[model samples]
Target chain A: MAVQTIGHAPASSSHKGMSPLRRREAINGYVAILPWFLGFLIFTAGPMVYSAWLTFNSWELITPPRWVGLANFRFLLEDQLFRTALWNTFIYTVVSVPLQLLIALGVALLLNLNIRGTNLYRSLIFLPSQTPVVASAMLWFFIFSPTQGLANAGIGLFGIPPQRWLWDVNLVKPALIAIAVWAFGGAMIIFLAGLQDIPQSLYEAADLDGATPFSKLLNITVPLLTPTIFFNLVIGLIGAFQVFTPVYLMTGGGPGTSSMMMGLLIYRHGFEEFNMGYASLLAWVLFLIVITLTIIQFSLARRWVYYEGDRD
Target chain B: MDTHVSPEVKNLQGQRPLMQDHAADDTTARSRSLVVPRKRRAVVVHLILFAVAAVSLLPLLYMVSTSLKARGREFAYPIEWIPNPAVWRNYLTAVETVEAMTFFANTMIVTTLTLVGGILTASLAAYGFARTRFPGRDFLFMLMLSSLMLPYMVTLIPQFVLFRELGWINTLYPLIVPAFFGGAPFYIFLLRQFFRGLPTDLEDAAKLDGAGFFRIWWTVAMPLAGPALATVAILSILHHWNDFIAPLVYLHTRDNWTLALGIRLFRDQYQVLFNLTMAYAVMMTVPVFTVFFAFQKYFVRGITISGMGGR
Candidate 1:
């Protein structure tokens, strides 16, 4: 909208008289933002396009890039490790996204109760989100330390046996999901704001009609809050797909690559193995996964996400 | 996106009784009783919130407790919630043991450089998108937006290879340089929104006075954007402070390591020494928590305002 100000520039003749100043302004803007553009060219965009090129070849850093068109993609078609990573990522994404969203929404609803010490609750809840991911992962690693972990100690009071968390092959993704859920406090705050935006009269009217809290939540709250949910879903989807820090720190995708995520695999191939070409192909595949999922979610959201008072 | 709340609705609200009449009747019947239930509800909410807060704080508490626990006591159970003789040396030893001062210096240098670079580049790019109308400007801005959605991991390998080729491996250059160039689209978008919300009269007046864009930006806009800039600065500082992967990938020498990577050194070197690791963890985490508390009011305000601004 601020562009409207520039669009309100004076006519061509007026512009011509001050051409040097305007040109200077343009150049100043360009110069100021030059670092970012240089970064994009040399780092992000450059690497991205190069990665695409690399995907078509067979190259390691030690040798020249051989002209082997689609070889990596062909390798991907039958790669067992690739298939395992794909499956793990899919399972993690599918299980975690809705679960995290629901937990966040529930927490948000609880926090929105206009209770005493709201700020205390908020800061405490958001603490984990602010904690360094590596530290938190390490903390969880200690907590899930098979025998002497606090998790088993606390829950053992209920007479439940100690179960392997990060150690067990099956429990690895769940361990990651638990960590993911702990960070939901941030998303919860966002959803709480969304909840606040809903007209209070809608709730009051529902209350007058003898709508129970549960009914009102299901009928009024969830439907209207879908837009925020959609936003979180998109961001969360992108985030879940790119999850690497926890995987790197906690398990290192261990139990024999059972928890090996696509991102970790990519990192391993590109950095450790120095198979830049194959890694780029994996990145492309992950990119396609995210892009396609985002598209699908956005398209599907039309049916569910209701924007009150929105004419469009 | 913040559409008008209709005048018709406002007038209708004024006309309607709403719950006013019912509330008056109910108040007459149970004004005294209302206080009891309200108090009870407050008590219940507080109790629940307090419990949740305790649960939320447990890991952090454990981290601190473990930091203070005597060596070999990290795994001791019937869980020693209190360390009988607190190992005060853990803090001193942790700091001295790991070249902590050097890592701290490196982190501060990298973080400060990245922070300064991020703010300058992001603000300028934001101003361009917000106020300029060059050819392909809109397309370029869209490109920037699309790039925001690109999986950052996709660029990691290629960028690393490029940095390796440029002899930037094992240096902070790779970590610091790109940040100056608007490496992050999210912050640029955030600042751009803030700039857009600002009144245009200042810029217009500056133009009339023959002052250029940069002059107006420095003299007018920067002063007005103090809060947004503070938000950007704080987030950037925290981000770089916590970044481990970048430093791990770029830095090879132990002396060159940042605090985050330095902390990881403990885990890598002494996997079984939970006490030392926890002590170092507390040392690393405490400062960040302190920083958060210092900027909390502005940080929360920035988050809410940004969300509202996004609308």
Candidate 2:
């Protein structure tokens, strides 16, 4: 306000006319976002660069880093645990992402129906998502227990013998996918919003076409809802790749390292073994995988993800 | 500017997605919504939705029931849906033996500090991004949003080392302090979107009144963004209260543990007692439940906004 020269300039003036005011505002912009920039420098950028540096070297926490170019990545290719962890994460994601999207979309469809008590139902569905991962894992740890767990009890009524859930190498991933589905309301709400945005007139048009319910869903709802599904897919994949808290609390990477997801594997190498260099290498690998997946997803959106007015 | 779209999908949905796109359509299924559902069908829909909601809620209900069970009742032959005689002592025991109250208090501290810091920085930065005439604003905004995709794994080891160097490894500082520096990119983005949606007449009026950037933002924009700010606050509660990975990594001491870490430690300590583990979960969950019930509207809107940002 003290700088009278730049004050109250004519609106929509040329840049030459409002240079000082513009410059001041620019400085303010930078200052406003400066804290985040500093955070990026400290917490994200520097560490990320260091992490990249570590990938080329081997350093236990105490020792100086020793160059071991490609050794960590090479070892990861053949290392049994890394392979298992990678495979576990991939399988968990491949199975769970679709399951979660499907469940969420289905529930969102139900809630989107002009039914009564939608809020109550939505709240009940969302309740699990609000619980901390540790608590849910703890609760589900007991529920999925082989002998006395409620899941087993429920299945036993149909004479299916109680199965080892998280402890079982093969079933552990599915068990996790199930838990992911149980907390589907987060995405469900998103889908509800998406559903709201879809024109009800489309349904009326489908009705005029004599489309079947399943056909209408497949043709109309599913196609229109692809963007939201894609969003959830990308976010969900990133989240699933970093699955740790539940694994840490429930399985501890398992009965025999069966449930060893990549996150836990990284934690083990970095913190437990004090092998910072190797952990950084693995972390870089995870980072690349995530980045690549996101890029691929975005690129593939060229084929399936619809924007209402993007065509030329 | 990073928008994406399928060229054909845009053209395709214009006319129709039916007919030529498929021959495998399930022609047998009736399009129910074309007509109002009969009373019988409505009952079926209600029943089905009820069942789905019940399944969604089963784990939570079981957690509460198990928390109230007495000795030998937990993991009994038949899974009990209700405790025979609810033992309120389990709650007392959880508080007494574990000092669970300490964990809750610690959680409150972390959440409060992070919430305050996060909202302030995010909203301040959001005003700049939305309202100020910033050179390279778009590019910098992209830079910040890009961090959302950067895997925390890449930063975990180095960040731990950095925090250790700063002597913040075992304290709440690692978790709470970064938040002051606009740690939440999603919220920053959300608030920026929100701030942009506000009518700018007040800002212009304040500016003509010789109010500087800070005053215009503080006196005009902030007051108008109450709903958006509440949404940020709500989402942050959802995030910070249930945070596990941060607490797991940062806080090493039992006494310093947030509720998430404390209950985890508690569960392991009482591994044999399923009911006792659940009691800890119940204790941790109650406050979150209360907050959710209190602010249900904001929770829904905030989550929707997070998803909506991609478009």
What's the distance in Å from true for residue B139, model 1? 1.8
Cα DockQ of the candidate 1 complex: 0.37
Q: Per-residue CA lDDT of candidate 2, range A77-175, in tens?
A: 789999889988898888877888888888888788767787788788877776767789889998898777988988999999989998787888788
Off by over 4 Å in 2: A1-18, A205-215, B1-37, B267-270, B307-311
Give chain B TM-scores in order: 0.86, 0.85
Instruction: Report lDDT (Cα) of residue B41, candidate 1.
Output: 79
What are the per-model DockQ values? Answer: 0.37, 0.40
Write candidate 1's Cα lDDT for B95-188 as tens digits. Answer: 8778889888999999899888888779888887777644445556667777877887888888888888999999889888888788477778
Native contacts retained by candidate 1: 0.41
lDDT of 1 by residue, A191-225 (tens): 87798887897766554443446777777778779
